[model samples]
Target: MTSKPVIIVTGADLAPEALALLGDYEVAFAGRTPQAADLVALARKHNPVGMIVRYGSVTAEVMDAAPALKVISKHGTGTDTIDKAAAQARGITVTAAAGANAAAVAEHALALMLACAKSVVKLDARMHAGHWDKATHKSLELNGLTVGLIGLGAIGRRFARMCDAIGMRVIGFDPFAADLPDYIEAVPLDKIWEASDVISLQCPLTADNKEMVNAATLARCKPGVILINTARGGLIDEAALFQAVQSGRVAAAGLDSFAREPMSAPHIFQRQPGFVLSPHIGGVTSAAYVNMGVAAATNTVAVLNSVREPAVGQQ
Candidate 1:
């Protein structure tokens, strides 16, 4: 049989076990941050029957070039990068490895909460610069604080249980989640804005809710509330967040993702007090990386082999 071709359209390569599952196929990787034109070139050259996406946008132009492309598998949960309507128009099956990385992401969310409260990054930098500065970046204890989660999906639920175990009250506004446990009491959006000492966003980025954390919402929040975002970057308005953080209205923020990838220098967040940032690695762990890779690879293979996939609540 002729070798089947598949392109990994981002920086990550599938784990060895995932690659082993595709022994019958040929694989190709596009180096990190490839231009759209370069990605289109790869599609033209490979004529791949399937594509595994991780980072960067997969536009309609790239899809149009691959005449044989039948499947597009997302390396992680977010499908916002891929042009789904365009793929569907071409009769391509789009799949994502959802919930496989929930544990890792939830752990990162907790890490951000601790980091924001304790000034982990800033203090480490202070020590590096030969200044103790312990008096300035005072730590906040979490034992009695209320944590408001924006969404109660896989990551949100895991984080909630962790907070509950630590003796913190857990509440949130998840309209989609029905029959939540006693630990997580669902509330209205207005209540989350007013009551939470720490607000962690876990909602998917919807067109209706983009930049939901804007000036209007921030004005209503309790002063000095810590903000944590391990979900989509587009969820928060960067300009409003900067002003809030600078003015001490929002005490601190821990962000694992940003509105712009490779956040530019002199951006509003630079040299700001009580804010920590990570480069979108919330779901990246030794185990989750491999699990996600395998899950996405299998999803693509299943569609190609006419094998039915288990129903997953994925976008």
Candidate 2:
């Protein structure tokens, strides 16, 4: 029997090719919805050298249970669910599949932008309900509109390019980017809110950015502005957004992610007009899934073999 280092994969749906690439390691499959306690127990039994976690939080207790764990690889870009400080304290290296799902997320954001501008959701609902009300004539063309993208990271840059290609003027706000693309006019964050006809958020949610798009910011925007968020949910204040839509300050909003996941059927947005919600499927495309899964698996193997260093930043 080959005595390769054991690896535990939680909620991973890796392709055969990707799995074959990790032939030197012995992998154990853990179901997608494994309980935290069950994961801890599995970690104890497997004594895994590496772990790949998908959705659930990898708590300190779970980390403590795995005495042999050397690395924790996140299947996606977000690391907010993991206890990073605790993992660092134990000297366990953490990495994520950042930029792997950028294309899919960018595409989704653009789709949302188009849907909001065209009033697609509202029109469809009205038609399905047997209402011939032609009062939904406020649909605007996106070509000449100003698009403000918050954060010019991989996803943000891609979204900006797409917007520019469609004839929209693209403006960006990314304090970290020393130089932006020629097509994107770098502007102040507040200026983005003031001048943009459509504002799409692509920035990560941080302590400094929680509820960044609150009532105060919404009040500063142009009247009937459209908002789209494909990034973290904490960036916008939900209650404030609800009020903004109710007051007609925000013409429409397309949200793929929310403060809470698997949203309740009777959420406020369902009753609110001009609101389109998705079940966090921005990066759920087949290509994106494969890209992220392979990147995560490769990173996990690299960490175990000491071929590469852990990626910096929390996400």
Which candidate number maximizes TM-score? 1
* 10 residues in a row with least lDDT, candidate 2: 306-315
The pairs that clash in candidate 1 are none
Task: List the RMSD of every prediction in angstroms.
Answer: 4.3, 4.4
lDDT of 1 by residue, 37-130 (tens): 8779988888888888887778999999898888899888888888899999999989999888999999999999998888788788879999
- Collision count for each candidate, in order: 0, 0
RMSD of 2: 4.4
lDDT of 2 at 49: 82
Q: Model 1 has how many clashing residue pairs?
A: 0
lDDT of each: 0.87, 0.86
Model 1 / residue 198 / CA error / Å? 0.6
